[model samples]
Target: MSSEIEELRKEIENIDKQLIELLSKRLKIAAKIGEIKSKVGRDITDEKREQKVREYWYTYARNTGIPDSLVDNILPILFSYSKMVQINPGKKKNITIIGYGGMARSLASLFSLVGHNVVITGRNKEKAERLASEFRFVYMDLDSALNWGEYIILALSPSSMDYIIKISPKFSNKVVMDIFSSKNEVFSQLEKLSEIYSFNYISTHPLFGPLLYPVGERIVLIPSKSTKNLEEIITFWRECGLNTTVSSVEEHEKAMAIVQVLAHFYILGLDRSVEILKKEFKIENLSDFFTTNFREINKIIEKVNNILPVILEIQKSNPYAYKVREIGVNELQKIRKELGE
Candidate 1:
């Protein structure tokens, strides 16, 4: 090893240690601020303060000739952690998640981070255990989970929801919620089952991807007739650092038809168009020519491709899907006509 290289490595290690110490100091101060906010009955997240800090970071980067990307990438995560430390859900509850998929992990991360006792359970005990291990939570069988949990989250696919009916009195009188993307028929079915089984049923759609600890994300809540404590549920989520929007079943479904059905349908069409064009042009290395817009679009296409089954399911089940697709086709035809094609 060269002496110069070893000296540079030692310098890097010292810088890394300093960085860690600085971050720790910052978080400790943030935690103290959180304590003050709690005493005054203030919300954990102050958007104005975050924006002011972000603006200062950008100015500092500009003056110091540092790249904007460095600050942009790190600041959001830093802010999320700061807010996570600030959140103190005074009354924590037992949350049972009924799947081991991405959404299950996302919710479990948030709930467990805020001191909620979380139990991961599903038909596949191994998968449940694996997810539970990631969050330092325990895995239990469905019967035990239902009995142990105060708030039960149905995090499985819509197709797998029938499994809920298999368990009887276990879910009785519990606060049960389903986290389905589209709630056309499944929500109603779950509501009926809740009635039959005597459970409090609420339908919810998390308006974000499967990112862990989805802090500052929005969740749509559609409380059914059995969900008498809607405000309490909303308060619980707000306390956990999530913004909640309450809506009727019909309103929620209508918004999703446009948000999910129309958006995914167009993105699917765009994906196919890109693939066919790529082959026709014999462009084997598409990334070599990717512009900023193309890169962003490709990212969305990749996400859609990974979740094609869920996308297709939403397309099929959403009642306004056909109408949205028809409008999309008509718009495309108008564009082609404009180009004299």
Candidate 2:
């Protein structure tokens, strides 16, 4: 047993050294790409190139007898390497976000860690000033916002973005994105921005919950073809531990209607079912016996509970949302009939 342990430790140390050397070379290559991008005014991420790399990795993993799931987990690390290389290769970029929530804090830290300046803006001058003071970054008023930073994020609540973007025209040449859970409303406002502006407006949904990020995560991007500069920003997040993928605004809305909207409804139903079961007949020490992941299920329950009401509100407001909800109900009935119960 001692001999086996020693051999494994030696193997791991050898692998780590080789990994460091390869990573150093990879970062050098990414820095070269970033330099070329800066010169040509092109974005850092080549989506076509990323796709090619993904296929290559998956094929290599298969040939090596590695499990598909293990390969999938490694993908985020690869993207992280690409991002870390682009931003720091040993330098950083300046970034500003128009909110003070989790996404704001995360982006601020991400940009800074990569060696860039980060600023946070808020709804009021006082609040914005206060946040800036806390972060030791600059604050901006409505009239005299700084035109600094190549990237700006609108990390506002779902209800308030239209008004926010309406008056912030200084984002003219810069790339702007929103971390809004839904894309329709924000895009409607971003659409009003002039075509003459050198802007790329994309909708981003960071899939991980606010509590944990970059561990096991993916970020869905809904970008207008008009907003081509999103490539670098996407790659940046990919390195910061997000698996960035593109979806059309239409596709995002359709996918979320089911994944976000109806899935929330189903989880709510499950919670209610569990409640009724507990009230009627208690299980025998089942709660204590549940696996560790069962505790994590509580987190999912919290997520669904929080989002259920909002999705329901959207369903009430939109005709398409109503149709989608109706389909969900029909599907539930069919499921019930198909089951023996």
Candidate 3:
């Protein structure tokens, strides 16, 4: 039995070494992929290819008895190193972030972590002065010190994006981009300045809550028009450890309506439903019949506890959110009348 155990251990060690060697070889291929994409200036992430990879993983998981969820989360991190192997081998670029708030600070740290300079800007003299005390070369405004940038990141609110793009006066030679999650309004506004610089803009929506994520998060980039240059920039973000998908403006906005809008409405409805449930006779007077009942209630309460702030966001940004709420109210009113409300 001892000799058998020793043989099994030796086999496991050899398999582990082989796995590492294969991963390293795959990354070498990934670096080559990066070079080709970078040279042609094509976006690194192909959603179709990603979908195929995901399908393969699930199929393999079923065969190997591994849970899909566990593999899903680690999928990005494992594949992301290939992206780093690709982009990190080249010259690091300076990325300018125009805002001093949460998004700006987050991007600054992210870019800095990857050995890129993060220059920040805001027109507010007081805020800029405070920001300048830091290391990312804070400027009072764009006009004062605008040029000498490679990739300019617009990290302001959605509404503020249009105002900055049209009036900024200095984006003529830069690869200007924004990270707004919804793109209908912003993309349409960019068309007004289409002649300012042909295809010099792209809008992106990071499919993540700002503070809750790191790199390898799904980032949907809505290119103004898919061009060679825009593709290279996509590669750049992917190399920075983000999974990116390019979309038409309509596709992005419609998707957000479903993703953010529907989700927000669902949570809001759930909270309202739970509140009504709490007023029920059982909740007001718990008994032996409520063993698991209290536990379920507590779980829902926890969900709503974190949902209030998200409700605020949905009410403000998602256009489809209010409509859905209106639908729900209308249906409830119909039910009430049927029951003689």
Give the winner by TM-score.
Answer: 1
**Which residue segments of model 1 deviate by more than 4 Å?**
1-22, 32-53, 335-341
Candidate 2: RMSD over Cα atoms?
Answer: 6.5
| Residue 278 in model 2: lDDT | 73
lDDT of 2 by residue, 1-341 (tens): 99999999999999999999998898798877766665554444566787888898889988999887797787767766665555422235567778776566565555554555766666676767766666577776533443766677777766775566565567777777777667766666675563445476676887664532242256788776557767677656654534577887778778778777677766777788877887778775557766767667767887767756555555543335666778889988999989955
Model 1, C-alpha of 80: deviation from truth (Å)? 2.4
Cα RMSD of predicted structure 1: 3.2
Cand. 3 TM to true fold: 0.61
Question: Roughly what TM-score does model 1 have, to 2 decimal places?
Answer: 0.86
* Position 325, candidate 2: lDDT: 71
**What are the per-model C-alpha RMSD values against the true structure?**
3.2, 6.5, 6.7
Instruction: Residues 174-278, candidate 3: write the lDDT tens digits.
Output: 777777766656666664454455537777776654432245466777766423487577767766656678788777766677666665666566667766877
Candidate 1 lDDT over residue span 153-185, tens digit each: 989887886576677457898999888988888
lDDT of 3 at 149: 68
Q: Model 3 misses residue 103 by how many Å? A: 2.3
Ranking by TM-score: 1, 2, 3
